[model samples]
Target: MVDIEKKIIEIIKHKPVILKKIYELLQAENKEDRRLIRKTAKKMLSDGIAYKDSKNKYHLVSSKQVVGTIEFTKSGNMAFLSDKNGDEIAITVENSLNAMHKDRVLIEKIGQWRDLPSGRVIRILNNEIERIVGQFQKKKMFGFVIPLNGKINYDFYISPENMNNAKEGEIVEVEILKHKSKNKNPEGKIIKILGKPGDPSIDLPIIITKHGLPNPGEFPKKVMEEALKIPEKISKKEFKGRKDFRDQLIFTIDGDTAKDFDDAVGLKKLNNGNYELGVHIADVSHYVNDNSDLNKEAYKRSTSIYLINTVIPMLPHELSDWICSLVQDEDRLTMSLIMEINKDGDVVKSNIYNGIINSKKRLTYSKANKILENNADENLMEEIGFLKETLESMKELMYIIRENRKRRGSILDIESGEVYFEFDENGYVKDILKRERGISEKIIEEFMIKANETVAEFFDIKGLPFIYRVHENPDGEMLIQLKNYLEILGIKFKIPETMHPKVLQEILEKTKDHPLNESIQKLLVRSMKRAIYSNNNIGHFGLASNSYTHFTSPIRRYPDLIVHKMLKKYIEGKNDLKKQDIEKYSKILPDISESCSKKERVADEAEWDLIDMKKIEYIRKHIGEKYEVFVTGVTKFGLFVEIPEKMINGLIHISELDDYFIYNERDNSLVGDKTKKTYRVGDKIKAVVAKADKLTLQVDFIPYENYIKINKKNTKNYFNKKNKNGNKKTFKKKGKNK
Candidate 1:
C-alpha cells in the first residue's frame, strides 16, 4: 500500500492525472491492485496529501496549496490561514468561500494582498459551526437569526416552522440545518431561547451560549451525582500519610464575593531565621478520580469561567464550593508546598506533600490590605490581632520575593485594567469601578508563583511527563511594531533579535511615570503571545522562569488538578517512575494541554465580552453626558479615547472633528486640515456620548462643541467659550461633525 501510494504521488507530482490515466501509467489494473490504488488515493486526499479537482483529476498538495484551519477576524471582514511552514496567509471575505471560523479548509495561494501573502479557500474539509447564538428577527413571512459572534457574517435563515415559537427580539441558540453557500444564508432551527436583550439576567447567558460553555450553576446529572457521593467531611482513611496543619495559623485571601477558596497560606520564622512559607492547595484530585465522570466533566470544562457575578466552574458546586473549598475553620485535604527562604527571597529548600489544613480565617483583599498597611480600624485590628505577626511577616516576605523576581528579570507592574461593577436593587449595573491590586493580592501572587515554579522544577529534574504553563517570547515583527509605536511617544530603544523579558522590563520602567503608561503596557502586552498550557517545557517568558506549571486552584483549573495527580504518582513512585504510566501520560498530556489552552481562551473572551456589554449598557443611560477623555490611540478613521474616571474606552470618528483630518503616522496623531488641531495619545478632550451598542460592544463619542452646535438654542446661554480663531459662536469642542 505504501509503495502504491508513493507511485500515485509520484505520478501526480509530475502532472495532474485522472484515475484511469494513473492506472495506465502504473499498469496496475488488476482487481486487487486497483482496489489498493483507489484506496490509497482516497486516503491521500482525505489526509491533505493530495486534492481532487472538479474534473476528478488528482494533484499533489504543494507550496501553492495549503490546508489549515480558517481563523476569522473579529469583524468577519477577513480571515487567516497558516501554511505548512507556519506562515500566515490572509483571506478576504470575498475569497473565504463561505468557510466558517475554525473550519478546516484547503486554500490556494492566489497572490499578495496588502503586502501580505493572500489566498482563496478552494475547499472546506470540515464545517465547525454546528450551533450559533443570535438575535431572532421576524420578517413578514419568516424570520432570520443574526449571529452575536462578530466573526460569523451570514444571518441564519429560519423558516416559519423553524422559529420554535421564539419571540422577535429574544436571543436564541440555533442549530444549523443547512450550511451557508454562495447565494444562500445558513439555515437553522431555534433550539433554545436564552432571553431578551437588556435583561440583566440574559447578559451572561448571551456570552455563555455564544461560547458553548456550561451554564452557570448547572452540571451533568451523573457528574453532580458523583460529586454528591464524595463526603463533605474528611474521613480518617483520607488522613493517612497526610501531615496535620489544622492548628497552624493558615488563612485564605480572596475577593469579597469569592466563594471558592482553592488555596490557603501560612508562614513562620525558621530556627535559622529563614522564612518558612506554606501554600496549601485544595486536593481536588483525591475526590475527582481518574476515569470517573467528575474527572471527565472537569476536563471538558478545563477551567472555570468567571463572568462578573456568575462563575461557571469546572467542578460542581458540591465539590468546588463545598468540600474542596478551604472554608474557614473546616478541616480539608490539600497538597502543600513548604519552602524555606532566606532574607534575599531565595528558596533554599522546598517540600511538597499531602496534607490537611483548617483555614483559621477568610480575609478579603480590602481588609487584608488594611492590615498589611497598618490602616485597619480598632475593632478589625483587634479581631485579627492573633494573626498580626504572621500577616506582617508575610507582607515583608512578599516585597522580598517580588524584588527577587525583579532581579531575575520578570516583567512586573503591568496594570491588569480589571473592572468591578456595582448593581442596582434590580440587578442592573449602576456603576463600574476599577479593581486595584494591592499588597495582599501581590502576597498571594508571589507565593503561588514560587510554589508553581518549585513543583515544576522538581518534576523537570526527575524528567517526568508533565504539563507546563508556557509563555513564548514575543514575535520579532510584533516587537518591531512596538518599537515603532514607542518611538512615536519619544521613547526610542532598539529591540534585540533575541529579546529578553528584562529588556521589556527596562522599557516598562522607563515609562513608569509617563502619562500613557497603561496604554504602553497594553500595547506591549498585545505584542506578546498569549500564555498557554503545553506538555513540552519551553520555560515561561513572562515570568522569566525556567520552569512553571499551574499547581494551585485545582478546584477551578483542570491543569492544576492534573498536576496534582501527576505529582502524587511521582512522589508515590519515589523517583523510580514506571514505564507504562509514563507512556500512557506522554500520549495523553499533549491533547489535554491543547484542549485546556483553547478552553482558557474561550473563557477569557466570554468574560471580556460580558464586561464590555455591561459597560455599554451603563453608558447607554447617559447618552448625552460629557466626559473628559484621554486620546489613547489615533488612526485615520478615529481617535480611541478612554474616560479615566470610569475606565471605559470609546471612539471619536475622524469626521467628528470640526474639519477634515489627516492621520500623521510618524507622530501617531490626527491633525485637522483646516483648524490645525491635533489629537494624539495623552491629549485630553471633552466629548459627549453619541451612541452605544451592546451587540458590537462599542461606544461612540463626539466632541462637546459639536453637541452644542446641534443644541445651540438650548445651551446658547450656558456655553461661553471661544475657538482659536476668536469666534465666540464656536466652542472649543464639537459633536458629531460627521
Candidate 2:
C-alpha cells in the first residue's frame, strides 16, 4: 500500500494529472489496486500533500498554492492570510474573492506586493461564521442587517419573509442562508432580536451574542440537572483520603463584589524559619466527571466569561457559586498546593493533595490591604485582629517571592487597566474608574504563579502528557521596531541577538521615570506574544518561569479543573499509566489545548467589546465636556488619545486641527505644515468629547480650543472641504468600529 501511495505521488508531482492518467501510470490491473490508488489520492488531497484544481487535475500542493485562514484588519479594507506556520501574506480586498474573516481558503501566489508575498483566494475550503449579530434596518420591501462585528464588512440581506417580524433598528442575530456571488451580500434570516443598542441592559447581551457566548443563566437542561444532582452538603464519605486544614487561618482575598471564591491562601513559619504557603483551589473536577453532561458543557465553554457585571460561568451556578465556592466558615473540597519556601523565596519542597478546608474569613482586597497597611477601621480590626500576624507575615513573604521573580528576569512592570463601572439604581453607569492592583492582589498573584509552576514542573519532570501554560518569546521584527521607537524617544537600549525578557525589563526600568512610562510599557506589552495553553511545554517568557499552568481557579477555568484531575491521577498511580492511555492523552491533549486557547480568546474579545461599549456610554453623558487626555497613538488621519483617569481612548481627527498637519512617519507624529505645532504619543492636551456613538462604539474628540472656537463649524467639511494639495479631503471616512 505504501509503495502504491508513493508511486501515485511521483506520477502527479511535476504536473497537473487527472486520476485516469495516474491510474494508468501506476499500471494497476486489479480492482483492489485501483480502489487503493483512488483512496490514496483522496487522502493526499485532504492532507494537503496534493491539490485538486477546478478541472479535476491533481498537482503538488506546494506548486504556488497554499492553505490558510484569512483575517481582515479592523477597517476591513485590507486582509491577510496566516498559514499554519504563522507566516502572513497580504491579500487585498479585491483579491480576497469574497472570502470573509476566519475562512479557511486555498490561495495561489500571484506576485509580490511591496516586497511581500501576496495571494488571491482560489477556493474557500470552509467558512465557520454561520451566524452574525447585527442591527436590522428595514427598507420598503425587505431589510438588511449591518454586522456589528468589525471584521465583517458586508451586510446580510433579510428578505421580508426571513425578517421573522424583527422591527426596524433592532439588534438581531442573523443566520447566513447563502452567499450569492463575489460582489453580492450573503442572504440570512433573523433568528433572534437582542434589543435596542443604547439601552444599558442590552449592551452586554449584544456583545455576548456577537461573540457566540452563552447568555447569562442559560445552560443546557441536562447540565443543570447534573449540577443539581450533586450533593450540596459534603458527606463524611467524601472526606476520605483528604487532608484537613479547617483549623488553619486560611482566607480568600478578592473583589468586594466577588461571589465565587475559588482559591484561599494560608501562610506559616516553619520550625527552621522557612515559610509554608498553602494555595487551596476549589475541587471542581471532583464533581464534574469526564463523561458527564456538566463536563461537556464546561469544556465547551472552557472558561467563564466575565462581561462587566455579568458572568457566564462555565459550570452551572450550583457548582460555580454555591458548593464549589469557598465561602467563609463553610467547608469546601480543594486541590491544595502546599509549598515550603526558604528565605531566598525558592520553593524548596512542594506537595499537591486533596484537602478539606473551612475558610476562616472572606476578605476583600480593600480590607486586606487596609490591614496590611495598618489602616483598618476599629470594628474591622477587632473582628479579625487575631489574624493580623499571619496576614502581615504573608505580606512580607509576598515581597520575597516578588523579588525572587524579578531576579529571574520576569517583566512585572507592565500595567493593565481594568475599567470598573459604578452603576446607579437603574443600572446605568454613573461613573467609571480604573481599578488599581494593590499589595493584597499581588500576594494572591505571586502565590498562584508559584503554585502553577510547582505543579507543572512536577508533571513536566515526570515526562507525562499534560497541558502547560506557555508564552513564547517575542518576534525579532517586533523587538527591532520597539528598539527603533525607544531610540526615537531618546532612551537608548541595545537589542541582543537572542532576545530575553530581562532586556524588556531593563527597558521598562529606564522608562520608569519617563513621561511616557505607562504608554511605553503598554507598547512593550503589545510587542509580546499572548500566553496560551499547549500540550508541549515551552518556557513562559513574561513570568520567566520554566514550567507553568493554570492551577488556581478551577471553578472559573476548565484547564485548571483538568489540571486538578491530572494531579489526582498522578497521586493515585504515582505516575504509572498504561501505554495505551499515555498515547491516548498525547493524541487528545493538543486538540484540547487549541480549543481552550480559542475559547479564551473569544472570552477576552467579548469582555473587551462590552467594556468598549460601556466606555462609549459613559462618554456620551459628558459630550462637549473637556478633559485632559494623552496622545497614545499618532496616525495619518488622526491622533488616538486616552483619558488617563477614565482609561478611555478616542480619536482626534486631523481635520479638526487649525492647520494642515502632515504625518511624520520617522517619529510617529502629526506636525502642522505652517503653524509648526506637533502632536505625538504621550503629548498631554485638553480635549472635549465631540461625539460618542453607542451604535458604532466610537468616541471622537476635538481640541478644547478648537471645540470652543469652531462650535458652529462643520469639522468634517473643514479646510474648505479639501486638504493642502486640494486633491480631496485628507481624513478618510470612519469605518465601523475603526
Residues 1-738, candidate 2, lDDT per residue (tens digit)? 568768877777777899988878888788998899998887676455676766888877676787767888777788887554446788998899979877777888898878578999988767768888888999999999998887888989899999999988888988889864676789999988887767787887678767778889899999989999999899999999999999988998899999899999999999999999999999988999989999999999999999877899988989988899998999999998899999999999988889999999988898888888889999989987777898889998999999999999998888778768988888778899878898899999989998999999888987888999999998765576577668878888788777788889999888899977877876687679999999989889999999999999989888898888888887787655456657777866876887799799889988888898888888877775789998888889999999988988899998888788999876778899999999877778999776776767778888878755554445534323432211222233342322
lDDT of 1 by residue, 270-339 (tens): 8898999999999999998998999998999999989987888898888888999999999999998899
* Alpha-carbon RMSD of each model: 6.4, 6.1
TM-score per candidate, chains pooled: 0.86, 0.86
What is each predicted model's overall lDDT from 0 to 1? 0.86, 0.84
Error of 2 at 162 (Å): 2.8
Q: In candidate 2, residue 556 scores what lDDT?
A: 89
Off by over 4 Å in 1: 1-68, 82-89, 108-117, 165-168, 193-195, 475-489, 709-711, 714-738
For model 1, which pairs clash? 703-734, 705-733, 705-734, 706-734, 706-735
Task: Count residue pairs with overlapping backbones in model 2.
Answer: 0
